[model samples]
Target: MVNNRSLVIIALLAVLAWLASTSLYVVNETQRAIKLRFGEVVETDIAPGLHAKWPLINTVHTFDARVQTLENGQSRFLTAGRNALIVDSFLKWRVVDPNRFYQATRGSTDRAEALISPRVEQSLRNAFGSRDVNTIISEDRDDMLADSMASLDTAMRDEIGVEILDIRLKRVELPEQVTQAVYQRMSTERHAEARQYRAQGQEQSERIRAHADRQREIALANARKEADRLRGEGDGEAANIYANAYKQEPEFARFYRSMQAYRKSFEGNNDILVIGPKSDFFRYLEHPAGGASK
Candidate 1:
């Protein structure tokens, strides 16, 4: 009878332990939970820490409150200029209202993503549609993303129970055909610009060279003019000296000139001359006493 009583106590203790295990639940700081009784939500916002409910009657469903990422795969969009771009983007989100989240998406992250993704895609489409390719590719991209994020956050929170923390574009690319066309156009423009620069440089160079040549010609002409003036002045001075010599001593001047002519005519020992003996060239030679007639 004592042994039976001990077994009954042991079984009761075991049952109590099982009930305790099923009755208590824990919510971590990174998680938010909902309590449901008979498939009906009883509590939506169960704070962190231990909570109690009737064993086998109440159940808690917990979701990660931490940030989660959703990657929207590559999709094509058209810019304001009708240029096509392949864009890859991602989202950062978290559940803010567990009750509404469960109601809207049945507490499924996949369903939440499904509902949020279309809105994000639509926002991207609108942004890309209103902006040009250059604006989308340049620093204005940040502003575009911010605008999209703000709009998406507002709409998502209202329609779904998730708040978007961030939206990021991973990659943006032009289609292969567009890329080739753009490259060719850019190359052509660069070549035209280079040709224009070369032409301007050539024109400037020609102007400089022409100016230099003109200056050189002017310098040479001025130098020649100065040289001719100096030569004429020297000739005039020599003529004046000769005139003074002739006025002071006419006979001596004649004799000196005759001697100079003779010296020049017989400058070399092999010099030959054909002249009449009584010609004027021999007058001074024949008259040694300075008695030649003028």
Candidate 2:
């Protein structure tokens, strides 16, 4: 009888331990729990620490109340110009209403991804598709992001039960063909600009050289003209001096002129003189010292 009582007591203790283990739950600081009995939510627990529940009949579903990140796959889209592009995006979200999250999504973060990813992709396409290629790639990117954020927030609130903390695009890229074409166009533009700068430089250099040449020619011509004018004036002044000298003494002038002519005519080595007695060359030549003027 004592052995049977001891065996019964051990069985009871094991059953109590099992029940106690099933009924108790510890909620972490980052988690919120919902108690569901028979597929209907019976209570929602927001505070952290230990809690009690009926064993086997009640189920506690825990949700991460902390912020979460969801990164989207690469999505292909087109701009207004019919150029195709790829966009990579991500979202920051948190569980605001655990009851709503549990009811609509059963606290399955994966299910939330399934619902949010499509909406994010759709929002990206809708915002980017209406924009031109320049706007998509340029300073208007911020506006595009804002539009995407607004649209995504609205879509998430209506379609899913989570709040989106933020939405961002990781990358935007042109399609392969479009990228190649843009690169080609950019190269051509740079080449054209370089050629234009070179041509302009050549034109400027030619103008400078031509202007210098023209200035040099003008200066040389002016110097030649001034030199010729000064030479003519010098000759006129010399002639006037000679006339004054001749007017003062005719005989002396004739004698001086004869001496100058002799000096000029006898300058070289070879000499030939053909003159009669009456010629001007013989005026200074006397036949002999006594018979010269007789």
Which runs of model 1 end up more than 4 angstroms from their true locations? 1-6, 230-271, 275-294
User: How many clashes in candidate 2?
Assistant: 0
Per-residue lDDT of candidate 1, residues 2-25 (tens digit): 999999999999999998899988
Q: Looking at model 2, report the run of 10 residues with the lowest lDDT sum.
A: 285-294
Q: Largest TM-score belongs to which candidate? A: 1
Query: Who wins the lDDT comparison?
Result: 1
RMSD to the true structure for each prediction, in A, is 3.7, 5.3
The whole-model C-alpha lDDT of candidate 1 against the native structure comes to 0.90
Q: Could you give candidate 2's per-residue lDDT for residues 1-294 as a string of tens digits? A: 999999999999999999889989889999878888988988875578998989878989999888889999688898888888888878898776677788778889999888888887877788888888888777556566786787677667666557888877788888777798989999999999999999999999999999999999999999999999999999999999999999998667877787788788888789876767666554655532222243
- Model 1 scores a TM of 0.80
